[model samples]
Every structure is written in structure tokens, then in C-alpha cells.
Target: MDTVIRMNRRQILTGLASGSVVAFAPGCVENPTLGRSQLILVSEEQIAQLSAQAWQQSLQRERVSRDPALNAQLQRVGRRIAQASGLGYDWEFVVFDSDQENAWVLPGGKVAFYRGIMETMENDDQVATVMGHEAAHLAGRHAAERASQQQAAGIGLGLAAVALDAGDVENTAQWAAILGAGVTFGVLLPYSRRHELEADRFGVDYMVRAGYDPREALDFWTSKAAQRTGRPSVPEFASTHPSDETRIAALREYLVARNYI
Candidate 1:
């Protein structure tokens, strides 16, 4: 986690009132994989607990595929990335019987790959592209960081409410509007972009370490980019992710800089 703790208006006001100064959350830690510090209000225990519940829920909700080949491929590729990451997570990968081009990994190395995404992958290398990226998200501790940031933002909004109350501003409608804008622009959008890019860069590193060609990563994204040709796209500033072009360009630069090409 990031080292310095910067309190928002709510913490500042509370400290002044109570004559005490401290961080809103005390669980900041440095992550070796990300090469930076993070504000992790949510602990590993909490994430594991929640992930266990979520994994169970997913098992009940989604249709799990029992194809032997699919299961074998997921286990093989996922294990390679897991080994490269050097994290001793009890990894389990499943293929869901759905047409959604999506895959996600929970904190405890619980992964779900939709049949749609699997069908789109041309080779095991492409599967490794998705696997490495999702694994990098876990290694980077992006989930806990996002949760902490949102908690801080919520505290800021609470403080703003207090300030409004002190000033006798009774317009509840106006307060809601301001809070919505603060959360959308301040907390959610920016961090999402950063997380995606970080995952992309570190994902390629994992791919190379796992003995997968980095070029396949670029190819996978290029194909996905083509798929988005006729669809609408949110502007980069307001979006939760970098545009495909931006993401692909960054991947190319990383591959070149690291000599992974």
C-alpha cells in the first residue's frame, strides 16, 4: 500500500473536534508484486471470507462445465501462471456454460471462465493472456485497494454532509447530486483505469515468466478491439478503463521495453 495517509475533510474535521489525529483506516501495506504501497482497509482474511462466500454463490448460480479438455486446459495454464506469480493460493479454475466473453479471479485464486471467452481464445496462449491478467489483479491487490479508496470517498461524503448540516443547508436533493459526482469522478473512474493498465503490464510479465509468448497478448487484445468496432464506447476520462487502443499501445511498449517480444 501507499505509505503516506492523507485524510479527507471528514477525518480532518473529526480530528479537530476530538483533538486527535489519525488515519481513517490503519491497514496500509506494501505489495511486492506491484512495487508500490497500497491503502488496504480490507484485510486478507476479509477478502478470503468474502471470496469463499462468492465462490459458493457462483457455483450455485452459474452452470459449471464438466468438459474434461476445458478443465484440463484451465488447470494447466492457470497453474503455470500461479507458479510464475510465486503465490501459494489454492487455485481452482472453472468453465461456466455461458456465452459472455468474461473471466474473473477472486482473491483466493478462484477463477471462472465463461464459455464465450474460451471459445474466443484461438490457442492456449490466448487463454494464458486472460489468466495472467486476472492473476496479476490478485497479485497487485487491486481489489482491496479499490475497496479502501471507496471507503475513504464515502467518509469524505459523510463529512461533506456534516459540513452541510452545520451550515444549515437542508437541500437533500443537491447533496445527493454532489455525492454522486464525487464518487463517479473522484473514486471510481480514475483508479479503474490505473488498475487495468497495471494488470496489463504485470500480466505480460507473468506470461513471459510462464513461458507464453507475449505477442499473443497483443493479438488477443487486437481481436477484442475489432469486436468493439460497431459498439459505443465511453470517453476515456469518464470510463472505468482505458480504450482498447490505449491498452494495446501500452502493451506494445511494455513488451518492447522488457524484451518480451
Candidate 2:
């Protein structure tokens, strides 16, 4: 009985790895905001449902700050950017009471900013810098595209695993793990960096449209780069985000081209 169960599991894995698993045909849809076509395997409704769950989880997991000043500023900047985005995603912004210099956005316009990052901003224009960037992620439909890419990569990795198993390769588990890391660092991370750069460019555009000083975006990113001067740097290729210098340089070029500076 045990041997039968083991064989059945192996067969199932092998079948899946051999591309026998059924899935929707991948679709490339035009994203008007980004001016590009994106591979979107999942529906917007599905991504929104997931985003709502994630938003709830985040509220439950993090210590939500009730600081009136912080909340007010976040709302002020967030609304302008949201309006500029024109995505109409039922946008919600919450400030987490953390010292980590981090912020993130979920699909459907859910935005979270940490108190630490908020404190770093010297003025509303600086706040607008980050706000517009988060808004651009929604405008770009990045979450759905990222999920689709991962889904595709998973199937490819499964095939690699099955091939190794069929060949009776030694340390198949180790090889599979290595292959998974390769997909992450090589494929996914690079795409993430591209997304970051795209956001930076479009975020500045949103800032301008929302009546914020676009040059402040350059100042904000430059200060961020300086703050990281002493920290250990991650290689651009391996990191999920571009280096601060890379971001600042790109932002400067865009601002120049647009004559915003």
C-alpha cells in the first residue's frame, strides 16, 4: 500500500512536470498607462480578491499607527496621487508604526507606508514622491503581471525537475532547489527591477500632473541614495530593486528630458 501511494505521487508530479497540467492560455493585454502589452494569466477580479485578503492580513499583522499627523499627511498625498492615477481602485492608505524604511502597494489601490519612511520626508513634495510611485504600480498593473510570470516560471521549473528525475540524476532535490533560485534571481528579480524603473519614470509624471514639484522627486531619491552610502550594497542583477544610485540617475534623466528640472 505504501509503495502504491509513493508511485502515485511520483506519477502525478511527473505528469505535471511534463506539461500535462491544464491551465488557461496565457494572454497579452495592452496596458494603456504603461504603453506596453503585459502577460496576464489571471483576471483583474481574481487579483482584486487576493489584494483584499492581503490588505486585511496586513492590517491585522502590523501595528497600525493612529498618529493624526502622519495619517493626515498620508491621506493628503495619497489622494492626489490616486486622483492622478485615474485607476479608481477604491484606494486606501494606512501607516504602519514601524521604523523600517519601507512601503508597499497591493493591487486595487491598497497602500501601506511605514512611519519610518514618512519621517524621512522633509516636506509634502517628498511625500508625494513615494506616493506617486506606489500609485504607478497600480497604474502599471504590476501585481497581476508578476503573479502571471511566477505561474509560468513554476511550470517551467516543474518540467526541469521531472527531467532530472527521469534521468536518475544524483541529488535531484539539490538541483531542483538551485534551479528555483536561478529562476528567482535571473528572471523574476530582473523583471522586478524593470518594474521599479518604470514606476520611477511614471511616478514623476503623476507627481507633475498632481501639481507636485517634479524636481523634488530627484531630491528625495538623491537623499535616499546618500543614506545608503555606508550600507552593504546588493548587486543590481541579484536584487529585486535597482540600487539607489541607479534609481536616482534614471529619475534625473527623465526629469531632464521632460524639462522638469
User: lDDT per prediction?
Assistant: 0.69, 0.70
Question: What does the lDDT read for residue 225 in candidate 1?
Answer: 83
In candidate 2, what are the lDDT values of residues 185-235, reduced to their tens digit?
766666667777888899899999999999898888888778768867666
Q: What are the per-residue Cα lDDT tens digits for candidate 1 across 103-174? A: 777677887877778888888899999888888888888766765666677743222211111101011123
Model 2: which ten-residue window has the lowest total lDDT?
162-171
| Total residue pair clashes for candidate 1 | 6
Q: How far is candidate 2 from the true structure (C-alpha RMSD, Å)?
A: 10.3
Off by over 4 Å in 1: 1-27, 155-181
Q: lDDT at 40 for candidate 1?
A: 71
TM-score of each predicted structure versus truth: 0.79, 0.81
Indicate the worst ten consecutive residues by lDDT in candidate 1.
162-171
Model 2, C-alpha of 97: deviation from truth (Å)? 0.7
